[model samples]
Structures are given as C-alpha cells and as structure tokens.
Target: MRNQGSLRSTLHQRGMRMTPQRQLVLDAVRELGHATPEQVCKRVQGTAATVNITTVYRSLDLLEQLGLVRHTHLGHGAPTYSADEHEHVHLVCHHCGAIDEVPCELLDGLADLLAEQRGFALDASHLGLSGTCRNCRENPTAV
Candidate 1:
C-alpha cells in the first residue's frame, strides 16, 4: 500500500485539497487491493459511514492521473485498482476468474527478446495475461 504522507503531499503539490472523503477513498482502495470504484465506495462508506459513489469514481480517476494508483482490466469485469507500484505481471485465470500477480522480472527473457528481435519495449506490468490456472487445468469443470 502507498504511504498516506506521500499521497497527501502529491495531492498538495497538485493543488488538490485533501478531504476526508478522498482520504477514505484512498484507504479503501489500498486496503481492498485490486478493487473497482463500486468496491471502493462500499469499503469507504462501511468505514466512514457515508460516501458518494461519484466521488469515489472521481477520486480514483484523479489518483490515477497523479500516479498514486494503477488500474487494469483483469477480465470481463470492471477495471481493478491497486496501490502497489512495483512492476509485476497480472495472471488472470480464464476458468475460475482468479487473478495472481507475478514479478515483472519473471518475463525479463521475453522482454529482452521482444526488444532485440522486434524493437518493441514490452511493459509486462501493464499486461493481464489470461490462462487457465493449475487448479482449473486440473479440474476442467471447476469453473
């Protein structure tokens, strides 16, 4: 999770006032890990007693713009947000709808290959590679 101090400072530098609502939203997003705007609103309201969904959505957008959070469409569902900044690859299970994050370095060989052979810079962090997980593979009917 992102440190609250740095997030607040980033907002301050951007001339964005840090409201309790915004803080609550941030906390919700961080705590919820990869969560949608609706999930964030629910978490925040559960803690703070009141919060608007629109406000949560707007705050998420602003936070993304500020680089405080990252979002990715892991499957057919809404985009999921994460506060983790480390480079990583998202492995989404097509069968059970489970998601796992593997270190970005795991794809270093592929990245280098892409860079050398295709002259393309591969950002594995932004990718959500989908496949059937081991459990799903073992039990084809699990899903």
Candidate 2:
C-alpha cells in the first residue's frame, strides 16, 4: 500500500485534493491486488455506502495518471487495476479462468527479442499471457 502522506502530497502536487472517496478507491485497489472498477466500487462502498461506481472510475483514472496504479486487460472482461509498484507478468488460464503472477524477469528473453526484431518495448508487467494452466492441462475434462 502506498503511504497515505505521499498519496496526499502527490495529489496536492497535481493541484488535486485527496478526498475520502479517492482514498477509499486507492485502498481498495491495493487491498484487492487486481480488480475491475465495479469491484473497486463495491469494496469502497463496503466502507462508505455513499461511494458510487462513477466516483471509483474517476478515482482510478486520476490514480493511474499519477502513476500510483496501473491497469491490465486480463481477458475479454473489464480491465483490472493494481498498484503501480506491483510489477509482475499475469498468467491467465483460459479453461479455469485462473490468474497467476510471475516475476517480470521471466519475460526478459521475449522483451529482448521484441526490442531487437520489432523495436517494440514490451511492458511485461502490463501484459497478461493466456493459456491453459498446469491443472487444466493435466485435467482437460475438469474444466
């Protein structure tokens, strides 16, 4: 979780004031690890029933703009948000719909290859690789 003092300072630096709603939204994102905006709104509403989804969306956008959080598309669904410092590659299982995280270093070779061949800098942490997980691969019928 980011320091509350720093969060306030960062918002102040951007000429924005930190409200309780924004703080709750940020807290929800850090606590949930990765969540959609609706999930974030639900978590925030748990603490403050008056907080709404629109507030959560605006807060997420502001937090992302400040580099305090980042979003990644896990599948065809809504994007999931996570703290900016939470750096890792996401492994999404297609059959079971399971999500796992691996160190970003695991993609070093791919990143290098992309950079060399296509001049494309890969943001490994911002990417999700979809495939069958070990469990699903081992037990195809289980899915």
Candidate 3:
C-alpha cells in the first residue's frame, strides 16, 4: 500500500480529485490483498455504505492505470486485483479451488525458455497455473 499523500499526488497529477470513496476502495484493495471488484465493493461498503460496486470497478480501473495495482486471471471467473508490488505466481488448485502464491523467481526458467523460443515475455504474476493440489491428489475423496 502506498502512502495517502502519494496517492493524493498521483491523482492530482492526472487531474483527478481524491475522494473518500477512492481512498476507501484503495484501502480495501490493500487490506484484502487479492480481491475481485465485488469483494472490494463489499469491503468498502463495510465502512461507507454508500460506496457501490460501480465505484469499486471505476476505482480499480483508475488504480490500475496509475500502476498502483494489477489484475490477474486466477480462474475462469472475474480477475482478481492486487497491489502492483505484490509480485508472485499463483498456484491454483483445480479440484478444490485453492490458490497459493509462490515467488515470481519460480518462473524464471520458464520465462527465459519462452522468451528464447517463442519471443514471449511471460508475466507470471498476471495468471495462475491450475493443477490438482496435494490434498486432492493424495485423497481423491476429500475434494
């Protein structure tokens, strides 16, 4: 999370005003770590009942544009938003829908391979790898 003063300056630099709703939305995103817009809206509304889902979506877009946050597609559902500084690769369990984060360095070798062979620079943090989790694999009936 960034300092409130810096957030205000960033908005001002873009000719935007810093509203309480925006601040709440940002606070929610920071506090929640990784959340969908709906989750953000719910968190914001916990403090400011007037803050709606539309505002959350708009704030998320602006925050992303300002490089304060980033979004990753963890599954087929809505993309999850996290602070831009939260750099990691998400390991998603296909069977139980569990999500785990690993250091971005874990993808360094694959990133280099793809860059050399396919000219693709992989943004490991922007997506998740889906696989059956240990629990699901070890105890098929548990899931």
TM-score of each: 0.87, 0.97, 0.96
Candidate 2 lDDT for residue 142: 93
Q: Give each model's whole-structure lDDT.
A: 0.83, 0.93, 0.91
Give RMSD to native, each candidate: 1.9, 0.9, 1.0
Total backbone collisions, model 1: 0
Q: What is the full ranking by TM-score, best candidate first?
A: 2, 3, 1
Tens-digit lDDT track of model 3 for 50-80? 8888889999999999988899998999899
Per-residue lDDT of 31-134 in model 2, one digit per residue for the tens? Answer: 99999999999999889999988889999999999999999999999999999999999999999999999999999999999999999999998999999999
Alpha-carbon error at 44 in model 3, in Å? 0.3
lDDT of 1 by residue, 2-105 (tens): 67788888888988878888778778877877788889988988877667888898988888788777788788777888775645788998878888889988
Rate residue 56 of model 2 by lDDT. 90
Worst 10 residues of 3 by lDDT: 125-134
Regions more than 4 Å wrong, model 2 = none
Clashing pairs in 2: none
